[model samples]
Target: MQAAADQGVEAIRILGVKLINPGDFFELLLRFLFNLIVTVVIIRFLYYPHSRRKDYFFIYMIFSVVVFLVCYSLASVSLQLGFALGLFAIFGILRYRTDTIPIKEMTYLFLMVGISVINSLTDKSVSYAELLFTNLVIIAVTWYLEKIWMQKKEDFMDIRYEKIELILPERRADLIQDIKKRTGLNVYRVSIDRINFMRDTAKIRIFYRQDSNVGPISKEAPKQTPPVDS
Candidate 1:
């Protein structure tokens, strides 16, 4: 009867206060810790072996917690679908910042957001068991994709490239040769970020195989080499 009475009280509720539901609050606590554990496992075991960024480690933990809270708070509203969509819409704007988000980190962000939405929302159609299973499935899939299935990805670099002559269509081979000589990267493709004919400079995004030595942002300037004979 006590359990039934409590359910009755919660069901008829029109509005929710953040701390009103102790059960929900505890669930949030558990969800936050679970997410943290899963995220750490992914980052520490899978991603860290590749990128090795400590800053991103901190950011992912904090970001996941904040997203979970937002979802939990909005779950009680009548228009939850709209609210959830609105939440993700805000993340889209994060891309336009000066430093673009990498595809990997962006993917993790989406995963965290999705987990948050799933963990927070209470629905009759989806029971607690289903939610638990859903979270576990996501973790399992991520582990497999990151660790087992995909062994490699193409490496990329953002360079302040300044070889306008080599970048021309007629000198494609020369460009590759020159870049390889200077940076020692097996550059497979180049993308133009900016062009300044006046300054004889063009910002280049270089894509290469994973074996390439160049990290995403290599501070050391490429050594100037003798111009490759055309």
Candidate 2:
């Protein structure tokens, strides 16, 4: 009978099933709720409003949950901090399976990962108050940076310029004026790409600020319609 009991214990051990404290489970649940709230505020209010990209809302939510569960599962580790840091370091190099991540989206990805790790790995030494405060600060800073301070500089468009004569180093002002007339944008600045002498055209990148605060500009600018050759 004793041998059978020992075998049963060993079986449970092998299956990684251990008795969990209810208090610890509750704490984890609370942390998950808090993190979800923070993530939603940042994604829905701060990010999506400005970007108008709905795809990342679900992506970030799912990613945060996955990361939180993984971190929570590894709670008994002696080197949990180092392990968590290494795990996020791995996430740092992540490439999107669907498409290449833009700089803004990638930054938000890092933020979501960081917040998930922090919430899931809440150390017993740190008070819940401190964690809440930390999350609030992150949300506030991101909201201010994204929606307020950097709003004016976010819109940009790319266009192809067939007026090779206006693309000269001396004619940069002319190029700016031309872009403003064509696009009806208060162009912040212009970046001239490689000039194709053979094609007699150059790609012009326009960084502009939208005047109204209604919605962001569409991602793709209209393709340049070059003049037809007679």
> Candidate 1's residue-wise lDDT over 153-225, tens digit each?
4767777777788888778888878887898767878877788989998888888765422355454577998
The most accurate candidate by lDDT is 2
Show the colliding residue pairs in model 2: none
TM-score of 1: 0.58
* Cα displacement (Å) at residue 172, model 2: 7.0
TM for candidate 2 is 0.69
lDDT of model 1, residue 6: 67
Against the true structure, what is each candidate's TM-score?
0.58, 0.69
| Off by more than 4 A, model 1 | 1-21, 122-124, 155-208, 212-230
RMSD of 1: 8.9
In model 2, what lDDT does residue 222 have? 69
Query: Residue pairs in steric clash, candidate 1?
Result: none
